[model samples]
Target: MSSYISLIEKGIHVSEKNVCDQDKIWSRYSHDKVDIGEELARVIRTLDKGMPLHAELRALSIGSSDEPQFRILETAFRGGLYLLDINDCALGIVQERIKRQRTDHVTTIKCDFNRIFLDPQKARDFFRDRLGKRWVHLATLHHSLYYCRQCCWLELFKNLYRGFLAPRAAIHAVLMSSKSKDPSTTTWLYNHFAGKFFGAYNDQDLRQLKKDLQRETVFKKAQVLLRTNRVNFYVDDFEKFMAVVWMILLYPQVHRYSLKQREEITQHVYHHFWRKKKPLTQEQDHLVVYKGLGRRGLI
Candidate 1:
C-alpha cells in the first residue's frame, strides 16, 4: 500500500478508538475551545439573509466525523445535511449520533472527496439521487482539507464547484496556517517539516489556490477570504498531545525513529509548540472562507 493510504488506515484506527472513548479523547485535546460551528453559522446567516423563508436550505459537511461541529450544523441549518467521510467507523458513529437527533434530514455517505472529485459524474448522480437536487446552499470542510493529497486539493475544489455547489453557494474551510511572522519563513518551515504528510498545505500552496480560484471560469466573481486567528491550546499532558499530533500529521515511519530521537522530537514539540499552563498559549490557525456566486448563477 502507498504510504499515504497506510497513514490513513492508522489514523482510522486511532479515530475509531477515539470514537469508542469520546471522553478520553476530548479530555486530552482542546477541541472544545474550537468553535468552528459558530463561525460557520455566522457565515451562513450572513449569506442566506435574502433568500425566501421556505426556499429549502441545504448544507454539506465534508469529512464529518463524530464531531460536535456536525451537531451544531444540524441546529444552524434549516434544511437537510449531506455528511461525507472516508472513514467508515467515524461515519457510522456520526450516523448513529445524527440518527438519534434527526433521522430524516441527515444522510451519511462513506466516500472520500478525492474519489468524488475524480469521478464527477458518479458523484453528481449519487448526491443528486440522495439529495433530490444537484446543488447545495452551503458546504463546509472544517479542518478536513489537510486530509487530502497535496496535489489534488485544487482539483478537489474545482470538482466540488462543478458538481455539488449551487450557483450562489459558498464553501467554508478551516485550514492550518503558518505560525511564523514571515510568510517566506512559514513556507520554508512547512515544506521542511510537513511536506511529506498527506493533505498538508503550506502557505505557498494556499496562495496559489487563491489565485487559481480567481482564474477559474466556474468561480467567477467569487469573494474568497482567508482569516488568521490565534486560539489557546489547552492540554493537560504532553504525552497525550504528542500522540494526537502524530496521528494528525500522519508522521511517516514513526517506528524508524530511535528512542533518543523520539524523545528529542517530543521535547522540541512540548517546549516550542505546546503551551505550559491552563488554556495554553500556542500558535494560531488560519481559517479560509470562500463565497462564490458563479457567473449569472451558473457554473
Candidate 2:
C-alpha cells in the first residue's frame, strides 16, 4: 500500500476487516478458486530445478498477511523468511504463527512497499538493516502489487533486482487482469463499476509487467515466464460473498466506493451472482522474472 495517501504510504492501514472477510472467503475453497499455491510451488520448483535450495538462503514476501506460502518457502529456501505487509495486524498474526511453529527464522516487517518511491535509499537501508548480510534469494509480491500505483512498478522491480534479490534469484507476482471479460470476475466488476462510477480503468495488470520485464534496459536480460490461472470465489452467505468482492475491488482504500456505489455494486452481485448461485471468478496473470537466467547481467 503506497501512493498519495499518506496513511497508505506509511503502511498505517489495519486489516481486521479484511482478515475477517478474507477468512470467510479462503475458508471455503481454494485451487479451484484463489489457490495460487500451485503457481508458487512452480516458482520454487523451477528455481530449484537449476539451483540448490541452500539452507542459508533468504526470501522476502511482500503483503504476506495471508501467510499462505510461508512454509512452502521455508522448506524451499531452508533459511530466513522476511514477511512484509502494510497491515500490522497481518504481521501480528503471521508472527504469532511463526513463534508457535518455527524458530527465529521468520522476520515480519510492517511497511508500505511504496516507500521505495518515497525514499529509495531510506527504504533500502530499512530492509538492509533487518537483512544485514542477507540478500533475498526469492522474492514474491503475490497479489499485493495492486496497492502500488502502476507508475511505481518499474521502480519497485528495479530496486528489487539491484538492491534486494540475490544473483540467480526470482520474483513471482500474480495479479488479476484489469480488463477481464468475465462478468463474474473482479477485473470486470472493477472495470464496469469503477469505470462507470469512478471513471478509472485498471491498467496495472501483468501485461504491463511483462512489457517492463521484457523491454526495460535492466530487465531485458532476465528470463520471464508468463501464464494465467483461474481463481473462483463463491460463498453461500451473501454478506460474506460481498465482503470478498469488496476485498477484491480494494474498496475504500483504492477506489473508496460511495455508499450508494457500494449498494449498487452489492445489488449487482446479488442479482447476477447470488440469485444464479454462481461464483466470482478471476483469471490471474502470472509473471516470474528470473535474474541471470540467460548468462546475462545479474541486475
Query: Highest lDDT, which number?
Result: 2
lDDT of 2 by residue, 1-299 (tens): 23223322122222225655565565465453225677778777666655654446778888865555676876666578887888877888787887888657777887777875336696578666877857777889887887888887888888888788887789988877778777778789878887898788888878777887788888766887778777777767666666666766667667877666666676677678877999787778888889865643121
Tell me which residue pairs clash in candidate 1. none
Model 2: residue 148 alpha-carbon error in angstroms: 1.2
Candidate 2: regions farther than 4 A off: 1-34, 53-55, 117-119, 254-263, 295-299
TM-score of 1: 0.74
Provide backbone clash counts, one per model. Answer: 0, 1
Displacement of the residue 64 alpha carbon in candidate 1, Å: 1.8
Position 145, candidate 2: lDDT: 88
| Top-scoring candidate (TM-score) | 2
